[model samples]
Target: MGRPRLGITSITLVKTLFLAALDAGAVYFAVVLAWQGSWGFLSFLLLGAGGVNFLLLSHKAYPLRYLFPGLFFLLLMVVVPVGYNIYLSFTNYSTGHILTKEEVIRVLTSREYAPTPPVRFPFYAFGTPEELYGVVLWPEAGPLLLWPDGRLASLEGHQVSDTDADGIPDVLDGRPRLSGRELLAHYGMLQALRVPWENGWLRLATLREFGYFLPQFLYDPEQDMLVDQRTGIQYRAGESGFYSPDG
Candidate 1:
């Protein structure tokens, strides 16, 4: 009788230690979930931890030894679907619903317009095909260096020489201008490059011409409408999407 009582005490001690360790892990997970603002997931973890502790520690739950199987199925049926739904709510789940309303408004408002009269300048492409190409624009204030990242620098005292005697300078700070053959070699990439400006972008119209481009559409938040600059068309936002007057 004495030996059996000692064995039961030892088993109870082991069970208590195991329960404590499990509870500690659950608390750690709860803290992490709370920090991440996942209150729903924290609540679920707490409920599961309580249920497991009750099943293992309570004498009244001894007859219901098969509770774990039921609990496992319950978690599968409830927790998985809940988590998946939460994930889907934060994603672009369907077509025509790609961006949130705020995100769409932000993108629309960032659209910029060019000046009333278009401004164009003569530019020469420099740098090898293997590197990012840079442009030298001949502004009224001598030559200006336009980096690939849209930064403008005045090359006033830089050794820019025009050996050809054309209006456009041929050399910039000792680097010879890229020839027409070199420009044509990387024509596709050069044409696609867009340099940022005050109100719009400077795009390569031709090998010698860099033209300023303005945003085609302008959005008004208060009116919730998009106005086309060239055609003077106003498109109002509807339940389906933006619709024109003709539509």
Candidate 2:
């Protein structure tokens, strides 16, 4: 009699689904990198992803399936980088000599400009110092519930009571409103709190307000400099990296 073949198991199905998801994500990311003109990193990503697919899915690579992953990452992360640095050592060490003028400009142009007349919203505090929550009133968007861990949600949908009808809700869900003095205790933790807004951030500007900030760095190709919006300073590429008015 011929040997019986095993049917597809639950574990095998889950593994197949997971691998498919991983490859799909890899393909999407590779496309993004290609569009961004990051060919060097894209090549590395493709090489690693291809190797992983071959090792995990191919019967021929079964022996090295587990071994290849660890080995491949070690080479990609450590060996390849160290070898590249060693190769760069053979070339001139000076930044101006090793890097092209455009490359220098690209490195110095890395800055973000916070828009003028920043978006500022008056916010009310809720919960407590240990676990804080806030409500920001935006003109167009109404009230937004801001959580301590950076979660943002529409306050209109959530159950909140306006006890005094002061426009600001007194109690959001079970968390009671906190007074300005009570909120003083939460000020330290609140400082670093930021919520995503307009591809930038909405962060605490003061105890009563939150403000929006975004990337605004403008690079002047003719001047070969990048302007800092905050300080209104222009910076050019120096021998080491950047030459700024502050320097």
Candidate 3:
């Protein structure tokens, strides 16, 4: 009888130590969650930890001895969703939901616009494959140099002349202009070139035409509204994850 009592005491001691270790791990997890500002998850963890310690350590709670099943179900109910939510917080979960407020502002402001009765110009491609340039020929405004930076300038003595009368200028600022064959070799890239114009962009519409385009929506941070550049319609950000004029 004495030996049996001693064995029982040793088993109880081991069980107490194991329960203490488990509770310590739970407390550590709760502290981490608190530090992360996840108050909701931290609350759930604390509750679960407290319940587990009480169930395992209390001698009067003999009927609650089968605590593993309850603990497993509690973990499923609490941990799974909290883990999934944490995963989503790091991802671009959806279209508008993906980016932060500052990122969205930067993206929206990058769009450009060309005013009504658009400023169109006849342009010619010039330069080597390493550096391509544009010269805009405004019928009444004379020739304006279109640099890659979107700057349109008229140089005092740098007038371009079509000496060969091929409708394309032969020389611009003493640099030989790219011929048909040379231009054709890099036609794909040259066609996609865009330069800044006023408050919008000047895009290569064709080999001869440059078109101006403007931003469709402009965000006003002060009023928290998206103003349509075309119609002047204002759309407020809605709680339903979209912008609407009605809101």
Candidate 2 similarity to native, TM-score: 0.45
Best by lDDT: 1
lDDT of 3 by residue, 109-169 (tens): 6766667787678767677756676555554456667765556777566757789898767
Per-residue lDDT tens digits for candidate 2, residues 69-170, read 689789879998998889777777633356676775565444444577767888877887667766545545677777777888777667788899877678
* Model 2 misplaced regions, further than 4 Å: 1-114, 137-139, 216-239, 242-247
TM-score of model 1 relative to the true fold?
0.55
TM-score: model 3 vs. ground truth: 0.51
Best by TM-score: 1
TM-score-wise, the better of 1 and 3 is 1
CA shift at 125, candidate 2, in angstroms?
Answer: 1.5
Instruction: Give per-model TM-scores.
Output: 0.55, 0.45, 0.51
Q: Which model is ahead, 1 or 3, in terms of lDDT?
A: 1
Model 2: weakest 10-residue lDDT segment is 105-114
Better of 1 and 2 by TM-score: 1
Residue pairs with clashing backbones, model 3: 112-214, 112-215, 113-213, 113-214, 113-215, 114-213, 114-214
